[model samples]
Target: MSTAVATATPTARPTSRRRRRIGSTEIVYLALVGILVVAGVLVAMGGGNLFSTANTAYMLTQTSLLGFVAIGQTFVILCRSLDLSVGYVVALCSIVGATTMAGDPSRVWLGVVAALAAAAGIGLVNGLVVTKLRVNAFIATLGVGLIVKGYLDTQFKGPAGDVPSSFQMFGYTRVGPVPISTIVMLVVAAVGIVLLTRTRQGYHMFAVGGNVDVARLSGIRADRTVIIAHVLCSTCAGIAGLLIAARFGTGNALVYSYGLDLDSIAAVVLGGTLLLGGRGSVAGTVGGVLILAVLDTVFNVLDVDPFFKDVLRGVVIIAAVALYARRQIDPASSRARFRSNRRRDPVRSGARPDPTTTDGGASA
Candidate 1:
C-alpha cells in the first residue's frame, strides 16, 4: 500500500514547483503595475492636478517630446546599446532648423527635411562605428555626441535664431482642446507599438537584443537591426529637438543638451524596460514619460526645490534597475540549481519523473 501511494504521487513535486514559478511571475507583474498606480495616485493627491483638462493637455504635450525619444531608446537599450548622441542630435537638429527657418516660415518644411536627413546621417555614422569598426556602443555614441556638439557650437555661436511661428504653432497649437504635439505623440507611439508587436522585423529585433550570438547564428541579420535601431533613435532625437525649439521659440543649443539624454534614459528605464536589453514595452515607456511629467508638475506646484527633483529621479532609476536585476538573478539562480540537482539525481535523469516525485525536488 505504501509503494502504491508513492507511485500515485510521483509527479506532484515537479507540478507544484512549476505552479510556484507561474505564481511568482504573476506576483511580480502585479506588483509592478500596482506600484505605478500608487505612485500616480500619490502624485495626484500631492497637488498635481492630473485630472484637469488643461493640465492633462499640458502633460501630454510635455511628454510628447521625451516620449518619442524614450521610445527610440527603448529599442536601442533593448538591443544592449546606448545612444549618448541623442542630446547632440537634438541640439544639432534644432540649430539647423532654427537657422534655416529663421526668416522664412514657409521654408520650415525644408528645415524639417534637412534635420531628418542630418539625423539619419548621424545615425549611420554611429552604426558604422559600432558594427564595422568594432567600437563599443557607449564609447562610439558618446564620441559622436561630442563631435556633433562641437560642430553645433561652431555653427550656432549660442542660440542666435528664433524658430518660425509656423513651427511654434505646431508645438503650441490645440486641436479641440488637445495639444497638437500630444496628438502627434500618440500617433507616433501607436506606430511604434505596431512596428514592435506586428512586424517580423520587430521579432527579429527582440531576438537579436535577447542574444546577439544566437540571433546571428539563426540568420537574423543582427548588424542591420542594430543600425536600424540607431537610425530610429536619432530620428526620434531630431523630432524632440524640433519640438523643444518650437516650444521655446528659440533654439537654445546648450540649455537642453545636458538633460535630454538623461531624461530619455530615465523615462525608458522607469517604464519597465531592462537596462541590459531584450525586455520592454512601448506602453511602459509612455507611462514612464508621463510619470516624469507628472512629477515635474507636482514638484513645481508644491514649490519643491529643483534639486530634490533630480534626487528623486535618481532614486527611481536605482530602484528600477535593482528590481530588474533581482528578478533576473533569482530566476536564473533557481533554474541553475534545479538543473544541478536534476543532474545529480539518477532516478530523475532517465525517465520522465512523475511530477509528484518527492525525491528532494526543489520548489521554485
Candidate 2:
C-alpha cells in the first residue's frame, strides 16, 4: 500500500496538471499581453507613451470596426464556413445606409434597418448557394463578392451618400478611454458569446461543424444552421459598414479596398478559432482584434507604410495559425499517449500492480 501510494503521487500530479492546463483562449490572451508589453517598451524607446489617454482611446477605437466584422466571422467560421463577400457587403451596406439616411437624423434607424436587411439578404443568398446548391463556401462567397463589386463599380465612382452628424457620434463618441463604437462592438460580442454558449442554434453550429454526418445522424438541421450563421455574419459586417460611414461621415464606394474580409478572418483565427472549424469563442476573437488594433497603433506611431502593415499582419496571422494548430494537435496526442501508456504498462504510468492479483506465489 505504501509503495502504491508513492506511485499514485506522480500520477495524481499529472492528472491535476492536465485538468488545469491552459486552453487556447488563455494562450491567445497571454500572447496579447506579451505583445502589449513589448509594444509599450518599443514605443517608449521611440519617445512615445503606449498607454497615454489619447493612445488608449485610439487603440480601442481602432478595434471597433474590425471587432464587429470579426465577431460576425466567428459565427460562420465556427460553422465551418467563410465569407469573402463581407468586404463587398460592407461597401454595399454603407451605400445603402447613407443613401437611405440622406442626411436626415430621423432616418438613422431607417438606414440602420435598411443596411442590416440588405446584408442579411446577401448572406441568405450566400448560404443558399453553399448549402443548397452544394457550392463550396469559399467559392460561393467570393463569387458573391465579385458580383457586388461589379455592381458598385458600375454605379459609383467615389463616395456618394451623406451621413448625419448625429449618426457620426457613434464613430467619435468616447467615454473616458473607451469609444462608444468600442462599447457597441463589445455588446455585440457579448451577444455572440451568449449565442454560442447558451443557445440551441449555437450548439447546432458546433455539432454541424464538428462533423456534418454525425450532426445529421443526431437529427440536427445542418443546412439551416449554416444559413443562420451566414446571416449573422453578414449582419455583423453590415454593422461594421455603418461604423465606417459614421467615421467618414459618408458612404464610400471604395471601402472594400481596405481588405476587411481577410483582416476579419485573420482576427478570427488569431483569437484561437480553428481555421477548419468546430471550436472557438467570441471572447477570444475580441482579444485577437485588440492585438491587431495594438499592432496598428504601434505601426502608426512608428510611421510604418500601409503596405508594410499588411505584410506584417500576414506574417502574424500565419504564425498565430501555426502556433494554434500545434497547440490543438499536441494535447490530444498527449492524452492519447498517456492513456495508451497506462493501459500497456501500469508501473511505467506510475501505478504499482497489485501482487495478489498478478501472482499467487507473491500473494503467499
Count of steric clashes across candidates, in order: 9, 0
User: Candidate 2's C-alpha lDDT?
Assistant: 0.91
Model 2 ranges off by over 4 Å: 1-19, 331-364
**lDDT by candidate, in order shown:** 0.78, 0.91
Off by over 4 Å in 1: 1-50, 331-346, 349-364
- Taking the tens digit of each residue's C-alpha lDDT, what string does model 2 give over 218-329? 9999999999999999999999999989988888889899889998998999999986788999999999999999999999988899999989988988999998878767
Error of 1 at 139 (Å): 0.9
Error of 1 at 136 (Å): 0.9
TM-score of 1: 0.80
